[model samples]
Target chain A: MATTAKSRMLTGSKAMVEAIDQEMERDPRVFVMGEDVGKYGGIFGSTTGLFEKYGPTRILDTPISETAFIGAAIGAAMEGMRPIVELMFVDFFGVCMDQIYNQMAKIHYMSGGHVKVPLVLMTAVGGGYNDAAQHSQTLYATFAHLPGMKVVAPTFPDDLKGMMIAAIREDNPVILMFHKGLQGLGWMDQLDASIGEVPQEPYTVPLGRSRIVREGNDVTIVGIQMMTVHAMKAAEQLKEAGIDAEVIDLRSLVPLDRETILRSVAKTHRLLVVDEDYQSYGMSAEIAATVAEAGLYDLEAPIRRLAIPDVPIPYSDPLENFVLPNAEKIAEAAKALVNM
Target chain B: MATAEIVKEIPVEKARWMYETMVKIRYYEECMVQAYAEGKTPIFNIGAGTVPGEMHLAAGQEPAAVGMMAHLTENDTVTAPHRPHHHAIAKGVNLKRMTAEIFGRQSGLGKGKGGHMHLFDPKVKFACSGIIASGLPPAAGAALAAKMQGKNWVAVAFVGEGGANAGAFHETLNLAALWKLPLIVVVEDNHYGISVPKEASTAVPFNDIRGVAYGMPGFRVKDNDPLEMYRVSAKAVARARQGEGPSLIEIETYRYLGHFQGDPEVYRPKDEEAQLRKKDPIPRMRNWLLEQGLASEEEIAGMEARAHQEVDEAYAYARESAYPQPEEALADLFEPA
Candidate 1:
């Protein structure tokens, strides 16, 4: 007789770890390498319990040399071994951007399709934890701007589990940006969406698909990662005010689901793109441009963007809160778009 | 011009192969220079004809390549720098395909996407990059894969003296040592990085000595003798294969040509190239082979003839090969459906 274990709620970080564990169990070629990923169980606990389960051979703890380890992942991937390389923080891309952009991103293309780099580069992004400019910036837009890489930022626990598994199985190089605010760590504040029921079996929430988390007819609000949580809250507030709002969670940035966005905008007739990354030339602007270029005729008002106002994330809570795109700011932007 | 000491331990068969491989690299470079000149002369333009683009000739570093490459099989991986043709040839990359790649033909290693600087032959596990010091980290990765997969293969990174000072070099060496990865770091100390000399760029007098900081053995072999290079490289390769971790081997050599095809070369003294040519590895190896009774003069001549004929055939094949279609440019950016 088959025994069915009762499903329990898992935090986003736990779900992520479970997903990687399942993939590693399924494929022998899959392995993990990064700083503090072995004994410390990842700074964010995204790799918790992986080291004991997989051993040192698979769960490797690397030195603080991002360039070497990341490049090694690229090489291992090119040799047909799937590697999951983690950058401690998205803000640390400066040390190894060449390996990420030049080697990992362009090698397959530069090799004239002779090679394939199937690797997942996971990193912690966003700032609500009083970490200064260097540690707390959502730089997924910079990665998304680059071609040859698929950038994903999932907020919900289930989506995090699904995307992490999908990224590992992808043939193309993937950058998985996990928002710190959504990780549900005991040390940091958590979101309700972080603790949700995740399926025990392996599954993939296909990339390039935007989920309409909340449906309404007045306006469309788009958010990714941490901003998605704020957008959901903003929608709830807007509903209390009787102004029905729709929210979109953009899971993948490169293979963008512009159809879902445009379709939502065509029905709602308003757009408010919410992003935790910088405002200028970022995901916000990209969404605004996409809608303006393709779905302009369907819009009722000018597209509004609520994002970090092009400044470094400060350590002070008040300063960070002022610049960050929270529910109040997103709700305000949505109300302005509806008023316009 | 006989040296006092000769390495007699190398088998006669292995000695002959080394001599032939050196001859092959020399002939390939000779043919490349002529082909490069044909496109350069008659008004010396950058993108003139046939074999276009500026070339970084690897004419004098054959000893370092041949010595280390002698112990390597097709399963072994090598990451090379801009001046990479010598290492690629030594690693047994298809001569015809490499020639076609230089000619920008569809039958090339990268199907003409990668030029001479970025040659890659997956079958032979040969890869290169144009960026300085960029190859070391990838070679570490290749070694990491070999270790993780329980394979006996090792990855050799061919860097220059100047590249040893790079963050990529130090970081990769440290990681390789820490992980006990099977990586052989070869710094071909040709004493020049384009116009700048090694002394001006690097703090250390020797590159191999830096390996001490990473907990790996370091050795320097002076003069470009194939046998000496082979002996030192053999120990390093054996240490790596036995899971003893990485080693840095610096080969003292010189470059006969300028860094690139059209380089004005105002940095070096006028007699420097002529002086370095006196100790050229190719002629020295040939003389050593004769003195050691490894091969007859006629046999040496026959090896040279075969090298010349092979390069000539490769050039002809490249010349007759078709250029990739314009739409083909958009094809290789992603995998085929």
Candidate 2:
């Protein structure tokens, strides 16, 4: 039986652990498999008690062979099991890409849409401290290149837990990328899926849809993961400038709900996309281009975007701050847009 | 057929299977040689092709295949190299599909996409790879998966002497040994990889020593002798089934044909092919069967004739079968039903 929870103070990372715990308890098929996830309590401490509580078999400790384990997970997924594999770091995905792109994503399309790989690839992304370029990267853009795959970036605990469950329930292969920078924040421990709210029973959050966390009428803000927090802060600053901004959390990128985005763009007639990844070929660029193609004529002004410069994320705090998009940067971009 | 009926006639049945397999491979290669000379298949210019100037055959390695694969179960997996005839025939790949694959027909495995070196028959657990040691890790993964699922299955990877000399083989073996994975490395030691002799490629005096490097039991068998190969491979296969870890069984074989079907034998001496032919395992097994009163000369000849006729018919069938259609090319590219 799942351990039911009400109000409790938990970090975002801890919230993810509790969510996975409750998920494993709710469904017998749901299991966690990854390297050192069993004995090490996760490199981020997200899964502290899980290994001892669930045993090593269900919470498998794999070899450093990412390709092998990923392929094994594909086979396991094909055989009717929901496997959530934790790639120690997002960069390690390069080693097991064949299983991710060729086998998992293409399984349904390749099998003539016969099989569904219900796999959740959870990996830690983004650079905050000195982990270097390899360990910390927003490589969700890499996944977005492929078809038949979903990319979910959750910023809050409740949304994180909900989106994680929704990703597991998805019939296609889904990549749930976690930014290392947004490790601990806040979320509802228990979520109700049926009514898009806290239910009397277990439930999940909807995918492919945007959440309007903060609403306005003057302009629309497309917030990507950590950018949402920055966007909210930017909105508070923009309020003083008499510019109201509607902030949208783009939960799932691939099956992006264009209706919601176009509706916001229609209401505001101006869009400002904020992302932490590199500006070139980044999510900001993708969203800006998508809006132009979909609602080009409806726009009163050209779309503006705020993102990290197209360079290796710097090591020093001074350099890194300039490299990544922050609240100040978002405010500056939004202020510039409103002034125009 | 049940194990009892199968084992009762194991010797005779295995020999017959060996003879028929040899005939299938021989005739298939002969057909490709003719087709290659006729310019029916295209030249890849660099890598991959069964067409003229791009193919490889196992003319003398038939015994190595029949001997080893004779010990396999349908549930077990087989990892093969580019020169994959022996494994292809041994794994029960349809003669028609096999020839079509060599012919670069749309009817081939991978639907003419992978062609010769890259055959993937999920129904029979045959995973072919052009990369020398590429198949080892996957086979090791398959074995681990089998063990995890608690299934009585084994995985065999057919590596060449050159690949057995590579690091992938060693790494895969170490991991398989550590996990006690139900896998076996069947090193088909044909002495030469393409043009380079085994000595120039490896420091280990013999390829069989490469087996012990993985901490698993190793064996060297007369690859030209089908029965001996069968005995060695059967023991290993059974041990793997019984939860024993991997084994390295090196079959000291020879390639009667060139490295590839249309390849010139300029690197080796002219009489080498003839010398290897003298140890033809099919006829050797036939002679052993006759002297032991297991089968008559007429029976063996008749079986060979039947085998030849079957191959001829399968080729004709493949030739007459419709080309897989342009639209169908994209189908089954991934895992389409």
Considering every candidate listed, which one attains the maximal TM-score?
Answer: 1
TM-scores of the candidates are 0.95, 0.81
Query: What fraction of the native alpha-carbon contacts across the interface, defined at 8 angstroms, is recovered by model 2?
Result: 0.08
Per-prediction DockQ scores? 0.64, 0.21
lDDT score, candidate 2, position B287: 81
User: How do the residues B18-117 of candidate 1 rate in per-residue lDDT, one tens digit apiece?
Assistant: 8888888888888888888875666889798678887999888899998988888988999999999989988999889999999999998888988898
Kindly list the per-residue Cα lDDT of model 2 for residues A1-340, writing each as its tens digit: 1337344445556657767888888877777877889878777655778999999767877778776566556655654567788888988887777667766666454333344567788888777566666775777677776876788887776666677777777766678887666665232212121012222233577777778889999889998677887788889999999999999988778767778888899898889998777778877778888888988886888899887677777777788777778778888888888778
How much is the lDDT of residue A120 in candidate 1? 96
Query: For model 1, what is the error of residue B236's alpha carbon versus the real structure, in angstroms, after optimal superposition?
Result: 0.7
Docking class of 2: incorrect
State which candidate has the highest lDDT.
1
Model 1: which docking level applies? Answer: medium
Model 1 stretches astray by more than 4 angstroms: A1-7, B1-8, B38-48
